[model samples]
Target: MVNVFEQEDIMNTLKHMHKWFNDGLINPDAATTDQGPKWCVVSSGQGFPGAEVSWATGRGKDVYAEPFAGPLYSTTSILGSVNAISASSKYKTEALKYLEFVNTDETMRNMFAYGIEGTDFSKNEDGTITRTENCYSPATYSQATYFTLYPVAPNAADQWDKVEEWNETAESSVLLGFNFDRTNVETEIANCSLIMSRYDKELYTGTRDPEEAVPALYEELEKAGLETIREEYQKQIDEWLASK
Candidate 1:
């Protein structure tokens, strides 16, 4: 654990990192740079379907990876986004049918997931798909279930299988089932957000020193009702725990 206030520890680490970055030794957006520095990092989703397509289509440079961190356990696996046909829509039934079709029908799902196949992507002899040179659509299939989408290369054919395996074995948080309803605490949250946004934009980006800035940030947050916000969340969490 790091003592955030300690100048020689966390603060020094930030300063050194900022200095290296200023000296051009460190890359901030290391994942998505088109410059193709000797080394970079990207998330799993970005690594496979993202950079692969960019490199293939001449839009971005190629880079290789050696694991910097690996096999980490997920603390939560809850779906943060929900997709559904609106109940008030006139075509609600049709919409539901379409939703069902997309989830259950692989062909339809692939059509939606990857766009016009041969134009947007080409099927390889090995069964993995590659993005076409003129494929304008971005692969953002997170809106739907991952399993339903077609497996695009340079992702291994078994990538989805690996994802499922990892999820099955991953750790769960103690607050797994707890969902905080902020209806009663919205004002406090908004005020706290204002304070956080004002400071975090600079403080986290190494533009502001942690020593002078973090304390002031906290002070502003407290004045903005962060304590009240925390208390309300804790109250809800306690009720959830007791119910569990």
Candidate 2:
């Protein structure tokens, strides 16, 4: 696959991005909104509905589904944002019991998922959930287990069964189990991060012309030892692949 920032590719990509902006196909002012490409890069339980509803609400005139261009890859490693109970908790036994309760108890799970159902939401005759008027979900992630959370949208309820199928069928990453220890490259990593932070927003959001920014970004990353970081990461990846 051609890197998006490569000299040949960057100019063309930026040209299209600029045209999209000029033609109102892209909204830079609302770049952080749920409808933004950045937020909807991949379908998510939360973002997908918001993006769909944007179309229903007359906000997604230019929005259309596009097929992903490249091969799909899922890391062998599991990904999550929630924290488990700490080992040192004073209520360790209680925490363990709570974990067991949430995992096994349907009523508790429903309560956590729906949030006092009559107030926050109500079940339709078809068994799908509809949010009550003037009510919002209380911390979507904190509700039930993520997987057990009831779908709020009609379409979502229909597609819920495919979530596991999609996850299981994704192509596994080549660098699956390896987590890079960047201690030796800490300085390089920090400098590269800083460089990306300075230029990434403008470049990624198409707020600035790539003709001027790309070379400068590359120059800064080079000075910041991006090559060294790449070499180190490649070494780890190669070793990981060999092991597998």
Candidate 3:
């Protein structure tokens, strides 16, 4: 990923952002806005195709979500949600058993995901679930394998099947399992992060001109040891690939 931040494609994207911001196509206060859920006519976020339903419900407005690109499986995405038992916990065995039950037992998994059956949610004759007004809603994927839970209303009963298919067919990134060991370059990483914190928000929010800001940012990053961090990442990736 050496020089990736200053690549031509990245610069072009920033330039497009600058044009949009200048033309009043983007929120002017985006760089400093603290208000949450400031509704806009359009927005982008990481989500599945059917996620628009939930988003629209939350914002009280009709919304449409279309994927800009195909899904690519990567280490970062896989690690987004995980449950880990504490090494120092005395209930490690019990925790493991609970996790196993949640993943393998359909009833337990569905209970955690959708709340009590016949109360918070009821299984429909068509195999979908009708959720009632309740405070027991949980992020389904984070709880257990999605296949174990019934689909909520408006989602197809075969939703999990489609999700499984998507996962099976998704292209895997070259860096799928390449976790960088930052031990050697911890200082460099810290310094580079500090430099990035200074300019990234303004540059990405289009508050600054990429033509001028990109070079200035890169200069500061280099001075802060970005090159050292890049070299270390490359070194680790090379070793990882060779091992594979």
Q: Best candidate, lDDT-wise?
A: 3
Residue pairs with colliding backbones in model 2 are none
TM-score of each: 0.67, 0.70, 0.88
Question: Please, what are the lDDT tens digits per residue for candidate 3 over residues 129-208?
Answer: 88898548876766767777787777777777777777787898989977888899999888888888888878887888
Q: Which residue runs of candidate 1 sit more than 4 Å off their true CA positions?
A: 1-59, 63-77, 89-93, 115-120, 135-143
**Residue 71: error of model 2 in Å?**
9.3
TM-score of candidate 1 relative to the true fold: 0.67
Query: Candidate 2: misplaced stretches above 4 Å?
Result: 1-4, 7-12, 21-64, 67-77, 81-83, 134-136, 143-147, 242-244
Off by over 4 Å in 3: 81-94
Clashes of each: 0, 0, 0
In order of TM-score, best first, we have 3, 2, 1
lDDT scores for all predictions?
0.64, 0.64, 0.82
* Residue 208 C-alpha lDDT in model 2: 67
Per-residue lDDT value at 187 in model 1: 88
